[model samples]
Target chain A: MKIALLGGTGNLGEGLALRWGKLGYEIIVGSRKLEKAEKLASDYLKKVGDASIIGMRNEDAAETCDVAVFTIPWEFAFDTAEMLKRQLAGKVVISPLVPMKKVGDNFVYVRPEEGSAAEKLASVLEESSVVAAYHSIPARRFANLGEEFEWDVPICGDSGAKEVVVDLTEKISGLRALDAGGLSNAHLVESLTPLILNVMKRNKTGELGISFR
Target chain B: MKIALLGGTGNLGEGLALRWGKLGYEIIVGSRKLEKAEKLASDYLKKVGDASIIGMRNEDAAETCDVAVFTIPWEFAFDTAEMLKRQLAGKVVISPLVPMKKVGDNFVYVRPEEGSAAEKLASVLEESSVVAAYHSIPARRFANLGEEFEWDVPICGDSGAKEVVVDLTEKISGLRALDAGGLSNAHLVESLTPLILNVMKRNKTGELGISFR
Candidate 1:
């Protein structure tokens, strides 16, 4: 399937592009900067040996792709998703943003009154199906391509889009995709990040990961 | 004021004992093993020259001190607080525990249904004024005597006992104690740890801290 990663120049964006590109899916690395996006596309192509990868401005990427995934920061998720409303209609738009506030040695999830970043994105893109996935997982670990994903990746969204996200999640080599209810239940899952950080700090272990028993 | 730390041999406990002791508060280092606590007490005496330092087992430490702080793991917070309840009434008991679940190069906060670790303690100790503070801040940053605390420490509790806990917070050099409302709001403050870890992991910054605007 064809996927355009809006704001795909980010750490999480770049990682997802590489991951899916390897699985024979068409990937267009979208950016606000056309030249930068094209350059990243070429760079990723060189690394992954996937010549079909392309680069385009976000609007063009959205228009041309079957689905679009947003890997933007919490602050930009709503605005960016709103801009693509027309183009993203009848298409799946995935958001993996988590609202965070920095505290000493750790961060806390600053919950938006409407709920989590995914819910916020869905609100902005009312015309599109917004599937929330990959908010709690760290992008760096997924980017490594060397590390194993031995845990469940919770996917939550409307019924029509839920299976699509679960399928996307399963495409990753080692990840197990689990249904964590619908999109409204995001706050509970998104809130898990801060709890994990506290455990890592207290245990004094540099390498930390989650496994749902 | 005389303060006893029931688990003073460890990192968080030792740090708190030193911070309070440096401010002319008599400190008692208490542990499961009297010998270890005594060794820790002497070490503190040598470093800061606080003459009133004493070492004892957990119960004895609670019996002799005017106030006590639990600087142990979340699992131990309940049992230890229960054991010290008889000795802690009519005296201040502080808890500083953050619950986290480990994930690869990351951590997530596992907020108890009672809300936070501090709220959990307060529920167990109805007689003792179990005030929740210091759950969000990193102990290592506060452990450095040379460093300055130009940050806010969110202190939450029963309004009647707020002053005493705020006073304890203010005594710790430069920390400004901000009333973070009631214990129910503890989840918002406690949820910061994992979000910080995600930022650290993504940015590759070893030392990161939060500053409220």
Candidate 2:
């Protein structure tokens, strides 16, 4: 299956691209600018030594790929979804956006008016199936290709979309995919990012991730 | 140290009482009625075969014990704090309360007006140090004494009280306590309860606990 990483120039997108590329899935790096996406795709290909990964504009990538994953920051998530509404119809879209604000060296979770980023994205792209996952994994862990990801990725969505996302999650080595209820529970999943960040900050640790046992 | 479990008639309180009582801490089972507290204390003692665990009214327990832990439900938490404010003065108090409401088959985290349960309790008992921990542990895991708790408990509070709670947390076998920033970040910790509950519900699993690595 072809997977498109929307806003794929960031660390999160690059990391996922590398991992998925190594797993033999076709990867398309999507960004607002085609040149930046191409550059990151080139860098990821070099890192993973895979020549099959390609890069394109966000709209074009979403229109062509089977799965479109939003690895963008929370602030731009809704707007990007709105812009790509026409292209993402009938395709599975994933959200890893977490809304948080830094307050005096402490990060606080800011609940969006739509409850969560995933819920908002779902509303914007009414024809598309939106699944929320990968919200809790640290970006650094994703970028470090050598490290095994021993963390649970909780996914929430409608049944059909959720199954697809769960299947995709299991394809990644050392990661477990758990079905964590429906789309409404996305806030609970998104909120974990700041909580893990707080844990990492106070404990003086890096790449903090969670496992449910 | 003499540790008091306020509202000790509940499952969470009973579990902690058994664990700490086994560890040789003086356990006081506190409740609204002294008789109920006494009965639970007797049952606990019988279960653990420890005679030192005692029962008392909530106010008396707070006044006498070194640490007062509010293991009550979120609905009764604020009122109970108000009733015991004078007795809890200058003492270290722990809030494991998670504010959540069940909607349909799933539970959603409802943030209190004061941001989190711990922050609300802190505001009510201004003279006491409020520490929030153990928000994510499942009650069944705690009550089943045979199982070793291989989970990370993230704690948040002022420096002094936080250290005391961390020390107490380490006393439990196979449990690791890590500082999770200050009291302002309590919402992040409290919010994890419902997320775990949702995960358990969707996955058809039990005793789902988190470990950060």
Candidate 3:
């Protein structure tokens, strides 16, 4: 299956592109600028020696991919979705955005007016199947291709769309996909990011990831 | 140190009472009715064959115990704290309450107007040092004394009182305590309950608990 990583110049997008590209899935690195996307995609292709990966503008990438995963910062998340709404219709869209603000040295979750990032995306792109997943995993861990991810990835959305995302999640080795009910529960999942960040900050630990036991 | 389990007739309250009682802490099972508290405490004592556990009214429990853990439902949390305001002063209080509502077979996190359960509890009992912990653990698992708990317990509160709660958390065998920053960040901790519950319900899994690795 083909996957498009929106905002693919960033750490999370780069990580997903590398791992998924290595696993033989066609990866499209989506960005605002075609030049930047092409550069990153070319770099990834050179590293993995895989020519199937390509780079394109966000709109074109969304139009062509089976799944579009948004790894952009919270501020740009909605706008990006809004701009690509025409292309994203009737497609599976994944949101891993966590709305947060830095207070002093710590980060606190800022619940969006729509309750969560995924809910907001669901509202803006009514025609798309929005699934909330991969929000709690640290970008550093996901980007580290050599490291095995042994964490539970809880997915929430409409049943049919959620099954597709779950299948995608399981295809990535060591990621156990869990069905966490429907899209309304995305706030709880998004809230986990700040909690995990706090734990990492206070404990002085590196790359804190969660597992369900 | 003496620990009080307010609303001790409930599953979570009873579980903490059992575990701490067996670990040789003076466990005060507090309830609205002294008789109910006494009955539960007596039952716990009979099972553990220990005389350190006792039962008392909520007011008396808060007054005498070094730390008071509120295991009551979200609706009664603020009122209970407000009613026992005088007794809870100058004591370490722990809140494991998650503000959530069940909507059509799934649970959604309802952020209180005060932001989180800990924040609301702090507002109600301004003199008490409120710490939030133990929110993500399954009540059934904690109640079953035979099963060993292997999970990370993240705690957040003022430095001095948080240390006391952290010390207590680590006293339980197989449980590791990690500092999760200040009490203002407690909402993130409280929010984990509904997320874990959703995963457990949708997957038909038995008693899910979180671990940070």
Candidate 4:
């Protein structure tokens, strides 16, 4: 299947593109700047030594790709989602953005007024199926797809979209996709980012990750 | 000063007991059963070389010690906090418990209706000066006081109590305590636990903790 990564020049977007690219999915890196998109795709191709990945402007990429994932920063997440609504209509829009504030030793997730980031996206993109996944997964982890992760990727969205996302997640190999309830409960899924950071800092565990009890 | 560690038989409680014991603070391991408490203290001495630490029943430990730290599970967090409320009056009660539900490659935070775990503790013990702190720090990190951890500990509560707790945190040698805000905001603080777990699982960084940007 073809997957377009909107704002694919970013840390998270880049990591996902690398992983999905290796899994035999057609990767189209989307960026605000056409040149930036090309640069990201070229860098990824060089890293992977594979030529299946391509790059294009966000609009063109969104129109042609079967599914699109948004890995934009919190400040630009809503606008990015809104702008792509027309192209993303009747299509899947995966959002993994989280709202957070930095404190002394760590960061705290400032809950959005409309509730969690996924809920806000779902509300705005009422016409499209917005699946919120990978909100808690660190970009560094996604960069190394060759390694196996034994933890569950808690996903939340409409049932139909959830099925598609989970199928895509399973395609990555060695990663489990779990139905973590409904879309309204996205706060529970998205708020895990800062908690992970806190645990990493306190334990002094460098490059740390988790496995469920 | 005397410090009581409720559920001191566990990983985190044992770690804290060893660290504080080395710093010259009297340590008391509290458990439901007196025999278990004594065993934990013995184990600490065995692990870290003997110093000064005693074990007792939870209530008696609370009554004897000036400060109390509850390092138990989230399932029993409320009851444990309530049981020790009378003994905790005028003293500080620190909670490091997190509520999490595991899903595929991630863990979603099961947020309490009363907000985060710390907020629940404050509401349950409104008569006491409840300070929510060390919610994100890993127990193993604190277990070895000789190991230096260049990280920050976010703390929030009554002003005087905050200072006292901050002072106590500094005695550990390498930990820096920062004032995050107030007790009402404990939801944000307590929710960090699950987020950390999710990040760790996704990244495959074992025993990972948080660090500020």
For all the predictions, what are the DockQ values? 0.04, 0.83, 0.84, 0.09
User: Model 1, residue B26: displacement in angstroms?
Assistant: 30
Candidate 3 lDDT at B177 equals 92
Tens-digit lDDT track of model 2 for B1-213: 999999988777888899999999999999989999999999999999954799999989999999999999989999999999999999999999999999998888888888889999999999999999998777877877887768889899975999999999999887889888899889888888988988888889887879987
lDDT of 4 by residue, A133-212 (tens): 88656567667656555545667786598889989887766566756556755776676666556545654654434333
Q: What is the Å distance of residue A103 in model 3 from its true position?
A: 1.1
Q: Which residue segments of model 2 deviate by more than 4 Å?
A: none
TM-scores for every candidate against the unseen true structure: 0.56, 0.96, 0.95, 0.64
Please report, as a residue range, the 10-residue window in candidate 4 chain A with the lowest summed lDDT: A204-213
Global lDDT scores for all candidate models: 0.73, 0.89, 0.87, 0.74
Tens-place lDDT per residue, model 1, B75-187, is 88789888888888777777777787766544666778887888888877777776667765656666666656555466656656767888887877666666655565567
lDDT-superior candidate, 2 or 3: 2
Locate the minimum summed-lDDT window of 10 residues in model 2 chain A.
A140-149
lDDT per residue, candidate 3, B114-194, as tens digits?
A: 867898899999999999899887888888888886888889887599999899889888788999888888878877888
Ranking by TM-score: 2, 3, 4, 1
The candidate maximizing DockQ is 3
Q: Is the docking of candidate 4 incorrect, acceptable, medium or high quality?
A: incorrect
Rank order (by DockQ, best first): 3, 2, 4, 1
lDDT of model 3 at position A19: 78
lDDT by residue (B1-213, candidate 4, tens digit) is: 999998877767877788888778899999999999998888887866757899999999988888888788878878977787888787777867677776665566677787667778878877666677876676666566555565566676755777788898877666667665666556656665665555455446555444432
lDDT of 2: 0.89
